[model samples]
Target chain A: MRTTIMPSVRILIFFTILTGILYPVGITFVALGIFPYQANGSMVERNGRVVGSELIGQGFTGDRYFHPRPSAIAYDPVPSGGSNWGPTDARMADSVAARRDAFIRKNGVPGDVVVPKEMLFASGSGVDPHISPDAALLQMERVAAARGFDTQKSDALKELVMRCIEPPQYALFGEPRINVLSLNLALDALEKGYPPPF
Target chain B: MITVSELIQLMLYALALFLLTPPLGKLMAMVFRGERTFLTPALGWLERVAYRVSGIDPDKAMDWKGYLWSLLSFNAFGFAVVFLLQFFQSSLPFNPQQLPDVSWHLAFNTAVSFMTNTNWQSYAGEVTLSYLVQMLGLTVQNFVSAATGIAVLLALVRGIAGRSTGSIGNFWADLTRSIVYLLLPLSIILSLFLVSEGVVQTFSGSRTVTTLEGVQQTIPLGPAASQVAIKQLGTNGGGFFNMNSAYPHENPTPFSNFLQMLSILLIPSALVYMFGAMVNARRHAWVVWGVMFFLFAAGVTLSLWSEYTVNAVTGVGGGMEGKETRFGVANSILWSVATTAASNGSVNSMHDSFSPLSGTVAMMNIMLGEIIFGGVGAGLYGMMIFIILTVFIAGLMVGRTPEYLGKKIESFEVRMAAIAMLLPSAGILLFTALASVADAGLAGLNNQGPHGFSEILYAFASTAGNNGSAFAGLTANTPFYNTLLGINMLIGRFGVIVPMLAIAGSLAQKKITPLSSGTFPTDTFLFGVLLTGTMLIVGALTFIPAQVLGPVAEHFLMLNGKVF
Candidate 1:
């Protein structure tokens, strides 16, 4: 005689709801209450409108702001990606050559602007938020020309970029990289807009 | 010589983590076990209502077939969800700004990366994912998928330990309670702690901040603290910020860094205790943990010794090529040990910057098959299987039947253990040889020395160990690598996992052999010698040829200043 202990279908749904819906929702809710700002993607807001999330990279073409590494995603948020391009892939080599050429043309920068490897190569995810200050300075000339400002104004902007460059972590964890999204946003605010909150 | 401060900091981190993790991990273990405590009762009640409405089995202990079906089907569903999110993120609601469709390769990479727990993300978290995608898809999957692995491992452990038992714990129950009571509560606490340390936890859009130098910048923001909590707790090493824990928004202070470190190891370290508890021999867990801790300490000592020597004395201008000065020697060594100690791939210090001998130690840790306090669910089972094999070998010496924790070790059990051990070794060697022979792998080499050979060896070891951290010097991730390492991770993780479960199933049916005069002494010093020999002879010998070609040759080349 085999006695049966069949789990009720009701119990299965019950467990699913508990595990799937209620659990995640509950954690999210608690997170929202305690740290409302970061709970919502660590976004910063001005004038009651959403801007961008602080943790993500953004498009930066404006000269006033420091430029991020060239991205394959072109700053696309969904479907984040990397080049996944190997060193010897002909296509990867062509892309690098094209980027180097474009870099030369933009600021009439020398054939050797001493571009950072990160700047030359697309980031693994392609949406990198930081750029080397050297990469930023290379762009400083063009931004000043576009704005009809003197080199001093650009130098000031460069100083601003310098201010934003986060020091190597605890003085040794990684190389210094300037957060592009942050730098550009500050540039926008610096030109007779509301001063950014430090 | 290893500095006293560096060693002290590492141990203090370990002790603090040890003290804090157990209660939280025990709670999580119990949650996974179907004990309704804290948040579980309410969640269970809600589940009851849903089950009644949907006519589903909330209590069914899914048989192997059913379990496999549910797992695969659900995973497929996750793939679809992520794909759909990528394709439709712009059109989707809650996206403040418009972004375009995802490229095909990146989407595939993200899908597999998350599903595999490699979480080797190429995308920046704040820029790419919409709030909805992060919340509804990635975050949700992060919790559930993690719970799923823990549930599966727990079931197999029960099967192995049980005598003549046909039942493993119910998967649905295990998954349900584990998330409700374990992952959620711990995440909440961990997230709050991080938030207090100034890690962002907001929905407000990006803010422009004027620095003291009067420069303005917009800081990108998102739901970082929440993801960071689960990423570490689950041993899934996805970073919300591209720089990982080094990101200011995610790891704002030293306190946050400590907490992040603690979260990554909480479960893995505690499972030693859990295994001890489950097997009814507390000493078994302690002994395993003891051996792992000592071995882990030794690896750290060697790696740090190599690193400091290079930094303080290297005549070469590029010795510490890409290290962050802020992290310095202490943090760098600490991260090396932490990343090696567990299978978590998240790294604060770049392994590429590691000196020659230090890099070898880091690589060697993975070569040991991650039995030194390894992955979240897979780690303990890995070590336990080794113990079973050790006992069997002891039995060979005594000419008596081997028994472990009361269960008799038979020929069938030993075969399964052998299969588990052989599978990963074969996967690595065959794949390494294939890669070494292939032009695709050879083309990726940049360092014009023997160190370059080590890059290939490290790649295979990382994949086979199921540790996601990389040397980064090797430019892997092309179709050649993506495909090869993908298969390696699949085989290395599931290949060993399935065999371990099979051993469990075999042992479960065997009669308990009581201790008698004929029984071999397992806990004695004789067994220790045999076990150490097995680790060296079997484990060491398997990768020796590969190591010689990669690191040893590279070492000679670096010394001679020429390529062979």
Candidate 2:
């Protein structure tokens, strides 16, 4: 307990302080300092009011808002679930087929409609916040018609969807996915009288 | 044993990677140590804070064994901590989103996954982990886990280079400094850079924004930058977004792509030089760097050549499926090389979509033990096994006592090294064979017959090697995959590590020997080539027949434009 380099008592205290206390404290402080907003779960704001975090996806079934990938959690942060059900799992296949069928029926589209696969299968985490542009496009006409906008206006909205499409990092890794949540935010601002396209 | 078609595709990718690692590795070491940065002053602030927190005193030297032990223990503690978090997530604080309690099997998988730095992620990233859990649990572990890897490598270098010295660097100091000086600042800046490139950096929840069609849209958000930084820095592949860094906001621009690529290989590449520096032999580092370069370049060229070659049959745009048009073949090949070489399994491009041959090369990186610039600490240590083998083999050929630097190679050292090297190869084979026979396992196969067999082989290889990249097509995370992979990751890493520690302890007690006429030359160009050959031969010999049975048959089937 009395060694010169690091006493046993000191060793216990030092390690406890270092790993249990300091390591967590250090990262937390840094996270708070640098990405305060993100450190808070990327909650979106509207007119000084708080909203959800940007990291978790939400459900929007009625062509009212762009939908995210299917999730068992549906944006719950704890107990984050995955549709880890295998491709052949009748339950998984059924859920996906149901989603596919519902998606088609709601939009009055055929089975072969090019809805992105990401939108049908439950994401690894049931809480994916983005959808494919193709999936978003699936609902464009429906949403536009419901909004009493010109049928032709769907094309421009699809372009806006493309505009918000996040390219691959380094343009090399991963399938291209549009953050349905972010694009919808831009759309909301547009609906409420925001100016030219971003 | 992998078919020529598969090997050829892999060779193209490897060739490019071989050219890429040295510069990237060198630059990363430099960057983490405070060399080149777009914003220098701010990075300095980050470093200072890290210093204060880790309580690093520059003057003290750490005993080699203590350092290695601390490195492993820290990770072991992390697993415990993450497990506890999941075990008690429903009762924990700041879990505002109110996620569910984690299941035991999946939680166990998560614990081993992150602690091992494989981050295989049986559960999805966002839903399973809370803001508190993500920031404090996974993200923190990412930094420390990476630091642990770097520190161990530093200790090994000391073991090799120590003439009569009894100690290596302090584990606490290295871990602290690594996270503070290397990982922290780099991640912060890289995070900001990613944000600037349009990656989201806020904690905003689902936003109800209206689209042109008047329908409301929701935007999801959380702490991305911190995780993004470590994901690449640590070479750990679990993503904040399920799509991982491939999500547009996570990696938005071409420039960000370059940054991510740079981040993935940064610490690993630099640690090679550090190896050289610690051993007092810059030439030794160069030799390792060169072999890594040769192998990496071959992978790149093979990948691109196969990608560009179009399908040997069918000829339908080379089936270059799952590739981002924006980045092209070059980025995919480079990413594959960097990720596989370093044990970072995060993928932007799906290996599943690659030609049968291209996928084989990528898989080979894991089977070869990823010493083609391997992971931060793990890669270097794995390479040291080969280094020991090279010395011993050469010594036997010449009837001389094997020596590295001043350390005499002995029976204990060689035996331990053999264990360290043999475990991963054994892991891939034993597990793959078990999987091939298991009906539950065979049910996970997506592609049929040989190619399907390759999928199972690849899963175990990647898991057992402590390399987490997947073939991506197989349905992992069932009780079968979850349990099997969890066991593999645990045994693969510690299986080798326990042996590694034994070797270290044994070597630490040995008296240093002076170089003599009969001593094997390890620093020359010829030896470097020999070491590389030894590594590849050992890898191919172990995995080739299985590969031939798997992807090889699939390749011919594809070339003949038919499924097996």
Candidate 3:
């Protein structure tokens, strides 16, 4: 017992410093050296001001911009989480219905046109950056109209959405989706006749 | 109902795992044997330094008692450091978020959870833990606890491979080798890859950013990539942030998600092959791998079907709630099955909002004691217990003694195996019942009726099985849950480990018998089927009643358009 205790404490302390301090700190340095843009939270700058991270979603309520998925935590990056509403929970059904109604009304889509499920359901992480391409397309009419785009400009806007659509990584993983922040940023760029964000 | 693309992706993932297994497994076997490998040139010096600094004689072996004692004492000391660190977190350095000291019960729960390799987080990470606690306390435990598991397994392997020997292996040497040779190098590479894909690795505090629409959002940043790598690789699923892998910065892209999912099963799956190499039973290892793969595939298929099908009550076409759009149904369901099966409970999607039947498959994976490619070394040992039971039953049918790898499976080995098998089951069921009747448990539920019951059952099953994935809806940070779940995590971990070491000790002292026609062949295809059957029967018979009251009952209620 005595033999075990001394070695145990010594070994624990040794590992604690090695793994706890040196490993993570070492990784941080290497990552910063190689991938500074990504390692430092992938923040996007607009006109030299930090606007938001490209990977993190922020709530966009205006008709001029494409909204991200409904956030359970209202797109708060800190203290992030989902609604965690069980499928059979009435509250889930109620919220989905409410979100669906809002989506149809806000976008001025035909009542009969199916709303994308991504638009109705809150994401697991409140700050999920991407939305399905279908979900983004449904909002194009409202976004283009708010920017006062004609039919030709709407077609160009649609093309921009197509360009913004990121296929699953290597075209084999995850869903084909669009980054809402980047798309909305691109929308601003296109309207102002500036270069595309991506 | 599965699409062609989803099918192709699943197959690709499986092929990747199958291809990576042999090399990783061989590397591990060499490391544990203290043989020279490619890594020895770079890492051999570190191992020697660890031994010298700790005053450990790496060549000196210990009996099973000494090995177990050393492991427990080290873990107990770890538990103390983690617990105390949480209490003094406000005073500790690197608390950029300025989070307060954790409450005592929650601290106890977090300590027990991480120390046991369960990583069942009751408190949110970004909001609760400081960088110092996250790094020194939790991340440190992630490496050591996983190393401890692999070390115990190495001891057991030595015991099995030994001939008329009392000494198993040196615990310190095994533990150090696991970190130095296997976990550290793998983690560094994975962490760097994840950083390249946008998983955060920084010392800076949360950045308050202005949105395009002029809203302020606080983006939490940390040395997340480093921890995320090990949390997946080690099967210690505690997340750096509250949303775990679901948060975009933590997982970033679909490619990152695929790799993280792969990392969850990487070590556990390879450890099966390592077991084979060490015991000189390569064919038997493949058979074990086959059974684990079969169980895992079945769970994934069922979860996909349930998730893809329209919800009967809500009439939703796809079960998209609480899932990220980028992952969609297939990736989310695959991750769900993989995480639970491997006992790597870090989630890219919320399990609570899954369709009732989909939720059941995830719950069932843990209830099976996480041996369907379970936690790093813990999974192989847990499956070995089942293997022992299968051989014993086969021996009984043929009216001869059971022999596994030339060692006779006598009464002592059988008894220890039974204790190992039964303890986790008892911990899960008993704790669920206790929590169910208590008002404190009832108060924590996010959903009512049977679904609420599922929340309580899932919590206990997760803790007692030492698989930390939560149903998430259960408000489990309260005193009642923290204390109960903490106790159960200890029981789930050591209960199996203690008995497993006993069996290893007993096996080491026993003389090997020559193979005869009467001996049940464990490496045969027939034995794989029998082993799979025994595992299912034991798991089903033990937990089916509780499962019925929870997910099963909820399934029927869901079909009937019942909402709670």
Candidate 4:
């Protein structure tokens, strides 16, 4: 027992310093050195003021901006989470129906066009940065109309949406999606006649 | 209903696993054998320094009792440090968030969870733990607890491979080698990659940013990438944040998601091959690996089918509730099965929102004891227990004595294996029953009816299997859950470990018998089938009634458009 206790305590202290203190702190240095922009939470800036992280979505309820997915925590990164609504839960159905109706009313889409499920459901991370391409496309007309874009400008905006569409990583992983924060930022840049954000 | 592109991605994942298994397994085998490797030039000095500072004589071997004593005492010390740190976190440095100290029961539960490698998080991490406590208490335990599992497995492997040798191995040496050689290098690489994918790694406080919509958003930032890497690689599964891998900063890109999923099973899968290399039974290792992969693929397939199908009750196509848009259905289902199968319970999506049968598959994966790739070191040993039982049963049918890896499988070995198998099963069922009947447990549920019942059963199954992913709907931070689940984590972890170590000791003393015609062959395809059948039968028999009450009933109720 004495043999076990002495070595156990010593080793625990040693590893605590090595793994707990050194390893993470060491990675911090490496990350800051190699990927400073990313390691610093990938914060996007506008006119030298920080707006939001490029990887984290912001709640976009205004008609002028393309909305991200429904957020359970209203896109709060501080305590991110999903609705965790079971598929069989009545509340889940109610929520989805409510979101669907809101999507149709807000976007003013034709009754024949079905809203994407991604637009209706709350994302797993309330701050999920990206939305499906279809979800993004569905909101493009609403965004264009709210910004008072004519047919030609709306066509240009559609082209910008296409440009903002990100392919899957290495073209073989995940789904093709668009980052809402980056896209909206790009939209602002285009409206200001400035260079695109990305 | 799976698309061609989704099917292609799944195939690519399988190919990556198949391709990477042997080399990583070989590297681990070399590390355990104390052979010179490519990493020896750089890491050898650190290993020596570790041994010298701790007064651990690398050459001094320990019998099973000595090894177990060392392991328990070390883990006990670890638990104290974690618990104490949580209590004093408000005064601790690096708490930029200025979070308050944890409650006593939650602290106790967390300490036990991490030390046991269960990582059943009762509290949301971003809201609770200081950076110092997260790093020193939880992250340190992540590395050591995982190394501890590997160490125990190495000891058992030595027992099987030894020729009447009393000593299994030195606990300190095995633990050190596992960390220094395998876990550390992989973590460094993966953490760096995760950072490049936008996982934050800094010593800063949460930043307040005003969005384009003119709303203030608090963005949580820390040395998250480093912890996220090890949490996956070590199969520890505790999230730095509440949403775990689902959070954008924790898993920033599709590439990061793919890699994190790969890392979850990488160590556990490679350890199967390490067991082969150590025991000089390559074919037998392949047999065990085959059984694990078969079950794992089946779970993924079932989950994909269920998740992709339209929900009857909710009238939603693709069951996208609680799933990220980037991952969609296929990637999310793949992660659900992989995380559960590996006992790496970091979720990219919430299980509570999964279609009924998909949730059932995830629950069943844990309830099968997580032996489908399982946790680092723990998975293989758990599988070995089932193998021993299978051999015993087969021997009985054939009217011959059972033998495995050239050693006779006698009554004592079989008894230890049975105890190892029964303890977790009994803990899961009995605790679930208690939680169901108790007001304290019933109050924690987020959904009503059968789905609510699943939240309790899944909580116990997750804790008892030492798989930490939750339904997330079970508000499990109360004193009642914290204490009971904490106790169950111990019962799940040590209950299997203590008996397995005893079996190693007994097996180490037994003389090896040469294989004969009468001896049952355990390294063949037939044996793999038999082993798979035995595991399913045992798991199904014990948990079927519980399953019928929870996920199965929910599935049927769901089909009839009855929403709870």
Which is the winner by lDDT between candidate 2 and candidate 3?
3
Tell me the spans in candidate 2 whose CA falls farther than 4 Å from its real position: A1-196, B1-73, B203-219, B308-315, B318-330, B443-448, B473-475, B506-518
Model 2, A1-198: lDDT tens digits are 112223222332343344334444554466566656545445566656544545445566556566666665454434333432221123443565577788888777777775555555555434556665677777776666655555355666666777887664433343456766677776666555574224
> On lDDT, who's better, 1 or 2?
2
Backbone clashes in model 3, listed as residue pairs: none
What TM-score should be assigned to candidate 4?
Answer: 0.99
Model 4 docking grade: high
Please estimate how well model 2 matches the true structure, expressed as its whole-model Cα lDDT.
0.65
* Model 1: per-residue Cα lDDT over B33-86, one tens digit each: 556667655566644554355444656654444554454455555656666776
Q: Per-candidate TM-score, first chain only?
A: 0.81, 0.84, 0.97, 0.97
User: Can you write out model 3's per-residue Cα lDDT over A1-198, one digit (the tens) per residue?
Assistant: 899899989999999999999999999999999999999999999999999999999899999999988988999867999989888899987887788889999999999888887888899999888888888999999999999999888998999999999987897887789999999989999999898877
Q: Which of candidates 1 and 4 is the stronger one according to DockQ?
A: 4
Q: Each candidate's lDDT (Cα)?
A: 0.62, 0.65, 0.91, 0.91
Ranking of all candidate structures by their DockQ, best first: 3, 4, 1, 2
Worst 10-residue stretch by lDDT in candidate 1 chain B? Answer: B311-320
Model 1 lDDT per residue over A6-95, tens place = 332333334334433454456556667766665554555555655665545666665544566666656653434444332223344456
**DockQ score, prediction 1:** 0.09
Model 3, C-alpha of B25: deviation from truth (Å): 0.8
Regions more than 4 Å wrong, model 4: none
> Could you give candidate 2's per-residue lDDT for residues B474-563 as a string of tens digits?
777688888888988887787777666666655655667767777677789899888987888888888889888877666666666453
